[model samples]
Target chain A: MAITVRIPTPLRTLTGGADEVHAEGATVGAIIEQLEANHPGIKERICDDKGNVRRFVNVFLNDEDIRFLDGLQSPVKDGDTLSVVPAIAGG
Target chain B: MSGETPPWVKGALRIEAAVLRQVEADALACYPSEACGFLFGPADDPPLLDEMRREDNEADKYHRLDPETFPRTSKMYFKINELRAVRALEEGAASGRPLKVIYHSHCDAGAYFSQEDAATFASGGTLMWPCAFLVVSVIDGEVRDRKLHVHVPGTNGFRESPLTVIE
Candidate 1:
């Protein structure tokens, strides 16, 4: 299934300045892998050393956060939109 | 107080006096805990901010979940829920007024932008959002002076953009 991923600005350099891109995967993790294959260096920005979504990045699979729906293993289908939003935070 | 004094940015961040009042009130209401929100206005070179969208501070939640990763609680930090951020962005665009400023409260701290603040506003050495920042100092539940900071593109720094208030 082809999914649409909303690329945050920081990773735009990898996506050739495109704000959005299309990838194929059955799960969110698989989609990320596809993104890394296409864009390179993107997986590292979204995932940590343990492959868990970075604490500061929010991954939403069509309105619901992936963390609330089985995390990276969350199932997906065609026409789903995945948004990776960097946390607006400060200390 | 009318904004007819010094420190006007001429063509940057012209805001409504009522908006500042709302921001101050919101900061005061969220005192002892950091508050955060966005100001929306027409997509002009120097946007005239006239709308306020308050967001709940979720730093405490993150800190509680993983203190090692998020070391600061709501007392010293603030985090806008990602969902709300997305929604607000869309809402602003749909209404023809894009996000112009992001304001936050700093408890017991001054209005100077901290290193961590710069880090949060940027990603991988690039700024994510093209908006100004307003830091409101709230000490012991009392709001104090505030400062505005605008990104200095390619400099990795920010400069004060004196905010002008309108009637």
Candidate 2:
């Protein structure tokens, strides 16, 4: 399945300045791996050493949080859109 | 290094009087809990405050997700709703007035950037928005202090910036 991944500005450097890109996968994790294969160093920014989404990163599958769904295992298909948003915090 | 104003500040951070009042009121109304919002303005030197957009502080969501590691409550910190943030960014882009500042309140604490704040805002040594941050300190339903800081490129950190309230 082909999916469109929206890359936020902070991770644009690894994407050759492209704001969005297409990758093929059956699940969000697989899509991320495809992205890594195409754009090196991008996965480290989104996932931690344990291969889990970073604490400050939010992955949305068509405006719905993946964490609320099946997390990285969330299923995807052709034309699905995934957004990687960095969590903003302050005190 | 210790002075009323930091010497590294290029100029005073100018904000509109009405906008400041609104931010102060929003912070006061969200008493004991942190409040967050976005500021829009021109992309010029010392950006002007054209408008303020307030969003809910969804820190409780994290507390419920993992109370042990994310121990902070809604009364301590803030997490801007991701959906709301995305909408705001899209609106800002469509209007040609990008997000110029991010404002939040610190309950019962001085207006200083915490380590977590630095890590989140300046993650990967790059700021999501090349704008300033406004930290408003509120105590007992009153505004105590407010400070502005801007990221120092290549330093991987932020520096105190002077603020000037314009009428």
Candidate 3:
């Protein structure tokens, strides 16, 4: 279950400059957990201090916004691509 | 009854002062989240700000307008009032005047367009020309910034002009 997760610019620090990373997981949450396990601080950036996803961050399972779908529980199969895009504030 | 003309309309076709004021006022009403609305068109010179709606929920803050409020569907996108958009289009077509623009707000943000905005523009479904995109950001419920963008098919796609509020 090798999955590729695309990281946004703000989260690049934890990934050591890797914009995208490969992880193995049966679900999106599992993949995120795997990412946190490897990078340590990446989870904090995606989720709020209280653990819910930040209102500004949108995680897409492929091109579809996860909120309209199953949200964080949205499943991911082998070779799936997950993209995390933060709400950009700059004009 | 009087307001500054829309910053983009200049010498060619000036948007009425009243309409411009409404755009600013509506933008402020939807603070902490982006506001959106329908620009009624084709009757006068520079379109009219006929109807306005504000989404206060901070569901998705990806662009100037909240994404959850303006969802991506097949034909048109988001929570826009279809009847209003249709009526504007119908009248514009009948009068041979283009609807001219599809406007929205961007709270507490600058005026430059973003990639999400570009993707929405490139969806290629609605009026493409004279059809401009507007952004208004309310900082602490004060309209600190406003911007207008028109598509340039030949260039990178949209040309932006910042708007100044006149007191």
Clashes of 2: 0
Q: B1-118, model 2: which lDDT tens digit per residue?
A: 0111222233356889999999999999898898999987754433577689998897888789777646898888798877678777677656666666788999998889887788
Q: How well is candidate 1 docked (DockQ)?
A: 0.53
Candidate 2 chain A, poorest ten consecutive residues by summed lDDT: A82-91
Cα shift from native, residue B115, model 1 (Å): 1.8
Candidate 3 C-alpha error for residue B130, in Å:
5.5
- Model 2: per-residue lDDT, tens digit, A1-91? 9989998877888889888999999999999999999999999989999998887888899978787789899999899999998888756
TM-score of chain B of each: 0.87, 0.85, 0.60
> What CAPRI class is candidate 3?
incorrect
Model 1 per-residue lDDT at A46: 94
Task: TM-score each candidate.
Answer: 0.87, 0.90, 0.44
Candidate 3 residue lDDT tens string, A1-91: 7889987545666888887899988777788889999999888767877765664456777766676567677788887888776532212
Q: iRMS of every model, one decimal? A: 8.0, 8.5, 15.5
lDDT per residue, candidate 1, A1-91, as tens digits?
8999998767777899887999999899999999999999999999999999986688999988787688899999999999988878885
